[model samples]
Target: MTHTFRPRIAASIAAVAVLGLLAGCTGGTAEETTEQTVTFWTPQATPERLAAQEDIAAAFTEETGIEVEVVAMAGADQDQALVTGAASGDVPDVILHASTQTGAWTSQGLLDTEAAAAVVDTLGQETFNEHAIEAVTLDDQISAVPSDGWTHVIAYRTDLLEQAGVEVPTSVTELAEVATTIKSELGITGLAFGTQAGTASATEGIQSIFQAAGCDLVVDGEVTIDSAECTEAAELFLTLRNSSVAGDFDVTSARAAYMNGDAAMLLFSTHILDELAGLDEATPATCAECVDSPTFLADNTQFVTVLDEENPAQYGAILSYGIPTGANVEGAQQYIEYVMSNGYVDTLGVATEGRIPLRNGMADNPTEFIDAWGALGIGPAHERTSVDLYGEEFVGGMAEGINAVYLWGMGTDDATLAGLVASQGVLAGQIEQLYNGAAAEDVTSAMKAAVEEVQASL
Candidate 1:
């Protein structure tokens, strides 16, 4: 079926001269395909990913006689390539993505929900995370399948806490308290953080506090970051900065610090078990293999899995995939279906932890961790205690405010409650400007305005 893009191309025919020159130069005299070959694209299209892709591709090609060509587009070219391919009518058969960008992309008319939905139905909704599927859906249509599910889980060094005569923390507040104690006892920053600023995973951990602070960055449809609830979340970051062993650590730095055996706990990727493989065995070792303690606060039952309805947060990453609608739709469907089947599930398990999903009737067959997680009421980890995130305006606005509060607060006196309260919206605007290319004062004004609107709405 023709989608909206058919018109965008037809409309572009007005540039016949430019199209003629490019078309002639590339393969003007060569015969084009009458028979179909499916093309696949993904950020994970490395040789390792190809192993999984090829296993299923070979099966499908042998079984159905459809050849699937897997592409490993350059990292910088991924988004551009997708855009170019979509624009040029050469889109891949299947694609993988983090569904958070789905909404924006779908809204801009870059996705095909119908093609993706057909695969999802055959695959079964339960095998995938419903929330992530919902995230990709626009106007009640599915956009992508939950390929690799991840949620933020609390990862702690069991031996260290026990050795230091410390108790494991069950809540964010308690976690902070333990950091303080660990700091004093070990004479090291009990928590490690911020090797660099504005990294993805690091930002994810920093934002988890929004859930824990009992105040999130959003309230309803407005930015509530300046509110008592959200401001407190920023305050917690100030606490982290003051107490953490490594100040302003990036993902590599944080992982290195923790792996080095200095940091006691990290609110990090639960899928870290992948790195943990033979990790404890690494040379000149820094940290021990911290036990997998899926402990949580007494009250909270389920853990947060952002963008993944099934398992959401292993501290903060979205594991998602999709099938492009335009070309070789059948081949795309086959590749996706194969991965969901029993044969390839373990490949995902190897990458993430039990964090990757198991095929239907194979859930218990997954790693021991998944089986244990099934029994947990909260099931492995606790969802952070954020007040609100689903709101459109509020969530985006508050994220900026929290980013400012934490980034400035790390390793500085500005990391106090008073400091966060006074400067949140002030510095939050700077990042807003950086992302949007606006004036600093305007960004601050925008945040203040958004906060005021939130107040009025409340």
Candidate 2:
């Protein structure tokens, strides 16, 4: 089987090169010999999580008599690892990954679409979140089974904003001005968005700006990176960067800067509040306010879905399970159906904060799981929800923001998105040059050329 990457991998080839390099690998246990067993791989590769997965597998075996082996791969490595596994004929029966890859993987002839559809049909299509199911569906084919999702938001200190006497920015232009004002008046970093080139964190921040402004790398097979909207987005990045104290920050440093109180705000996923709740145990001295307790979210933070106009098109990463073509299809189907059914809540409980229930449940109780999610403990304190640590209002805002998610390459072809990924650093590099005294027009011209080059690669 060949390994094909989705558009999501377009900007980060160095991070996902395992897919192309291992496409033709041919070393693995014979599928026929292990027909009674099923191999499963997950992105939750942590030691503790792996142990929990094994236990879940053990339970499945007890019910079906199908021996299962669970393997864990880090989130950053899962895409390429699965590609390598598929190429080498070592593909797992079930694979857990971002739902965004379903169309590409299915198109490459890697997934068992029939079995995927079967799982959804058996589980009742209406039970799953429409958006989550929509994410994995392409060309009328259900490529994977939906699992959970995370909402992206601008995490800011409410107290800081109130003290500055400014409202959260609602448009790209407002974002630049408000951020600059905050930096100047408060003497703190205005925003801590990732600017590190070619990394997922950087891509998330950059793409959020573009998507919010209704700009995309490619739209309807046309490269729009050099468009007026995109150029304006680039200018906004330059504006924010100049005032930012958290220079060249990635996800980690960005989060630290916010948690350390060095920056007033940061672009982050839903997991931020989860970490904040554990600040006392993990990094007691990280923030002065959280030194006494988990007080950051409770007292200071406010999560905003929009950093620009256009109704705040937020970005979210949906997690799903794709069954491979050559696996034990029957066992894999059973496992997926079981996981999304009886084990749904329990499976999500493993990473409650990050894994919001994408499937609400059957009609008799549509919000059974959604309401339950709010009561599950997420941090070291083991409270009902991050809301318990933060506040109901904050968490509610997060849920409302869920519908704002805008995918980067949603309707575009795989090759075009891949081209964009291959040229991911062009804009980032241009932004860096602008920071070092280059003219905005020069940066814009260079970025336009880079966009043309990537489009040509398609």
Give the runs in model 2 whose Cα sits over 4 Å from its true position: 1-36, 75-90, 197-200, 283-285, 306-312, 380-384, 414-426, 437-445
lDDT of 1 by residue, 98-191 (tens): 5444544455566666767887777666554444454555566776665654445444665567666887665556667877888888766666
lDDT of each: 0.45, 0.68
Put down candidate 2 lDDT per residue, 293-315, tens digits, no spaces. Answer: 65654467777765543455677
Clashes of 2: 5
Q: Flag regions of model 1 displaced more than 4 Å.
A: 1-35, 74-76, 195-202, 280-284, 287-315, 346-350, 353-355, 358-458
Per-prediction TM-score, please?
0.64, 0.83
